[model samples]
Target: MTARSSSAHVAEVEGVRVDTRHWIGGRRVASDATFTDVSPIDEQSIADVHAGGQAEVDAAVTAAREAFGTWAAMPVKQRADILRAVADGVDARRDDLAMVETRDNGSLLRSHLRGVMPRVAMNFRYFADLAEQISHPIDEIRGHRQRVSYDPAGVVAVITPWNAPLMLATWRIGPALAAGNTVVLKPPEWAPLTASLLADIANDAGLPAGVFNVVQGSGARAGAPLTRHPGINRLSFTGSVPTAGVIAEAAAKNIVPLSFELGGKSALLVLDDADLDLAVTLAVEQFDNAGQVCLGAFRVLVHESLHDEFLQRVLASASALVQGDPRDEATDVSALVSRPHFERVRGFVERALADGARAVLGGGPNDDLGGLYFRPTILVDARPGSEILTEEVFGPVLTVQTFATEEEGIALANDTRFGLAATLVTGDPERAERVSARLNAGTVWVNCFFVRDLGAPFGGNGKSGIGREGGAWSFDFYCDVKNTVFAPHGWHAVEGGGDS
Candidate 1:
């Protein structure tokens, strides 16, 4: 894929060259405070992003509110057609968007171009088709017919994370729009470029002004305001648990319904009868995207009978992974999003080692790369209660534990505060089914990992999240259901008149 020329689209604000800006009310807008975008690969300046705050958040929410009525009034087919056009627009700009995201978030260009971008467009199309099939269901009772219809939830605030900016943002935006809701999206400050580009694409696809808006800045400044804004009818946030708590409190003030997809320390279980090679492959591959994925298998629980063998294979596979610049197509792992994140991940490994956990593979930073690079680390003999095993590292570090019985494995996997996702690898289909039924996670993959169906519900339980997302779940979250009861024209109401 060819990289788009970024210089040609540079914007000038007050005689200063700016590469990023906010999209509010269908146009690019600048902000008084600016944040520099630095590439994680080399720590070089990539652009100056607009640092939007309360004022900008207010403007965005106001715009979405103003456009909600008109957007919600649009016919379903027309809305579907517009969503298809948006999907087409994203497909056309796939390469450019992939490059922007890779530069902004340190994702491998190959994966972004092949996996993330296509999935982004697919999400819009999926919701579009679902929207076309929606209908109001009616139930008839004694002298009345109740028609249950869905309506847009008015203005929605979508706060997305940096890990997979565009993909996750569209996960909220597509369904919200398809359900006739106007949206104000706040992309994490660490990766905001593609979100602005998405705003441009929506405008080109004929999305009405104020129907969709993008605000770029820190979570405390932009995201907090969006959550608290009274104009917003619903909130959908994907981030850490602490942040979700803060948002939950703010949304409660106005009784705004919310969908929270919070943090996870998901486990990948390798049963005694499982195919060891496939299990190792799946475990090591969890480090894809530098383990920033929320569903990543950070904790691996292997049957004691297979633990030693699995550990050797895991160590070898992880050691063979190539870590270099993200732009390098062959690179398996890229730098963390920033230096602070890198230090945090390194600290996890350092503390784990100091606590008597053995580093079976990588345990240090790659200083030679001159960037925020942490080696793909694997830890064994980590105490089950240790921070590395219990908390979310959110980096390319996998902690291994051993379980003697199938019951113990299941218990170990479900011991975390998060129940976002889990994986079970086993040759016995009966065991897979039985153990999957016992797992507390929202999604349990049997003999595989990251296998998703766009039509199925996706979310978490426990501290991981509040409600489901994806397909019909998205529609439900962004919409309000109203029941309209119509009584027979000449009917008279009487207490206890109806006969069973």
Candidate 2:
């Protein structure tokens, strides 16, 4: 066990690195079966977890359903209070959780995404404020008083991806709790330990028994049953297109309300008028989180005039990223979440190479890395249907292509079946605005890339996802809308109030 900084509020961190179980009905319980936690560094078992299944999912669902009445009936302020407590607890134990996240997820080269905590903390707090600000409608019918109010949606099932365990959880957890709903969380099996630890944080924060429950298991056995559970009122899912497609199908059986944050093959347009140096920096940074980020600018479209220079600058920037142990503060790029992810990304590169996509810079895995470390690859001249151009290579890989005009750049950027996010670097404000409007992605950054302020509404457009995940609009995703009109104590008005 390693000691943490003052914020963690603990003397030492537990390094036993054992597998995690589940949190059902407010307690840690083990499933009948278990699964191994494979280390990205050596492809060996570092830890294991209760091999969760339909039973565990059923238990979590039962717990949530049992508490849904009281939880949904609780005042919004009280629910907000519980959320605030969770945020405070997360902050209190930030460093320990960060370490565990790094250990479990094989953060590229392995960096605990704890850097995202400050924003996550803000997410919980912002949702708390938004809770108090939930709009209630007041209407006057025939000059008389009438009112409408919001209501809860019972149990919410939040299924988050391994790429960002805590941050994505916070996004859903904060709003669902604030909106007066009980939650059953199913973290990705790839990063179950950290998610279970987060459940512990909620328990310590004094969330009521069964108000928040966590289940650990695979999507097929656990996630499928959970989403299809009749008890679950809404499902907030973040993951891949194929998985999302499956979850959506199961959810449709019950006609459950769904909030999906899926994949993105986004683009970054480097305009000829942009600052070349800044453009280079933004390109690599935009693709931070090893391009695993759904919002990352994976595809780069540079104006033809600046293509050569921009390519050179971006290559140097990508080359400079220090990839190694995520725990090492000096490291910028870490290993992907697992060896499978490494292979998945490498396969994309290999397919590109097989095609005419030229290996402009890096192109494959770094054999020197004992762990799963891949060199930042850059491919140029990829054709329309190339793997590097169409699919998400969620690794330290970049693909570069040239566009003759701003229109062409925009066209190429939006040409994909995906529309998650895009960034434009241009000195001309008018040009940036014009391009931003034309790009089909949900988020468009001008002169900046992948930087977030926490308050912004974050989600995708088109295939990326449905509905927003942040800002005031977040309440709508978690809380169901009900219009209730109560008129004054008189039955004078008829259906046709015009009085023919």
Candidate 3:
């Protein structure tokens, strides 16, 4: 059968009964390990995906190792060229990928965040450009000349989460392979569709066999072994704090370098001088993807001076969002990752409501869409210590707290254990700058909530994450530094022999 550019055009595999499955190597591999992919909107099987236990994981590692020699040794420009092809391939099949991702993980549209495409290209191009930028420069250190160079870390294991699977997965993949390191990626089981699509793109782009391999499975069976693999060099993970800890511990057992991007309950400040309209827009936008984002602004701290007005406006905006099927072109909101997640958010809201917090706008789930839909609920008077404030709810629920003074606002914002990203809607330059610095996050925005470019270096400061993964330095996490010392002049052996 011929390859198709759209999901609509994908020729149905003969006798293939599942809509969801794993892509290992160049095809939909049947594995002894298997799990069913269920839609979050309704707890129903979309397809049976490959569980990809140790055998498949070992095959991926071996394949990556075999490909490393040639792929890593290729000229940086050549690598960049292949990445460009990958970007184009992703674009060519944008709709197809978007449908798969939306169906599996509930993404808005594949094309909207097709930043995955350009990001991979840019990531590769950035490192490709670095090849020329990094030159042997004679440096005199205390009267001695020295030189330094960067080398690949050999084999890397990338463990990505469900949210933003394509984008985040590429963020890890592009840089790792570009840095001359081979990679074995384990995408979240919830979103194997995007992983499968990316595997297809890699093959279409003609990536060297095994330069980048993806094994489909969960964190326990697939993730633990890869992280603890004796042959693996580094482990890069994006998930929650608890999981990150487990991966870190396992990597530590092997003495492998680990890059972890953990949980976050980021804060969004609605300063007194802020424009209410702008704040409302950003607040709603931040809740996109149902606030299942690592850098999501969960706590909306409004200055008490504007507390009444801000709460009223935000509640209005939240009420206006139509939560339903993600496939609907007009649906502004979609269901959470699963029924348990929806139930979990409901529980958090219930606890907050009982703790003197009042839900002025939305509190209950919309059972109309089969209970998978939860209204974009907002709570007022939620204290800092509440689970809604500290823990990563990772749902559409937003906790609104009031601050009487800028000091209170700053304190409340910094109260969380996370330092991923923060948003402040303020017109005052002085105040914005102050808030930006004291926010304690890796990235901050004034009048902006959740937007970033492909070139930005992004990571967390505290338990949020370790190391960044967006710019040329992104490769640093996946690479090793090597230095070679050589004699500037030929040895005096001949002259000494003559003298002797």
The count of backbone overlaps in candidate 3 is 2
lDDT of each: 0.87, 0.78, 0.75
Writing each residue's lDDT as its tens digit, candidate 1 over 1-500 gives 22233553353321323347788888877788887767687776667788999999998988888898999999999998999999999999888888778878899999988899999999899999999887788888776787988889999999998899999999889999999999999998888888888888888999999999998999888888888888889999999999899999999999999899997999999999999999999999898989899999889999999988999888888889999978789999998998778888888899999999998878888767756988888888997688998889999999899999998999999999899999999999898889999999999888888888888999999999999987777778899988887877787774355545
TM-score of each: 0.95, 0.93, 0.90
**What is the full ranking by TM-score, best candidate first?**
1, 2, 3
Give me the runs in candidate 2 sitting further than 4 Å from their true place: 1-19, 108-114, 144-146, 497-500
Model 1 per-residue lDDT at 125: 94
Off by over 4 Å in 1: 1-19, 492-500
The better candidate by lDDT, 2 or 3, is 2
Q: Over the stretch 78-101, how does candidate 2's per-residue lDDT look in tens digits?
A: 878888888898788776677766
Score residue 48 of candidate 1 by CA lDDT: 70
> Candidate 2: TM-score?
0.93
RMSD of each: 3.0, 3.8, 5.0
Clashes of 1: 0
lDDT of model 3 at position 405: 89
Winning model by TM-score:
1
Worst window of 10 by summed lDDT in candidate 1: 9-18
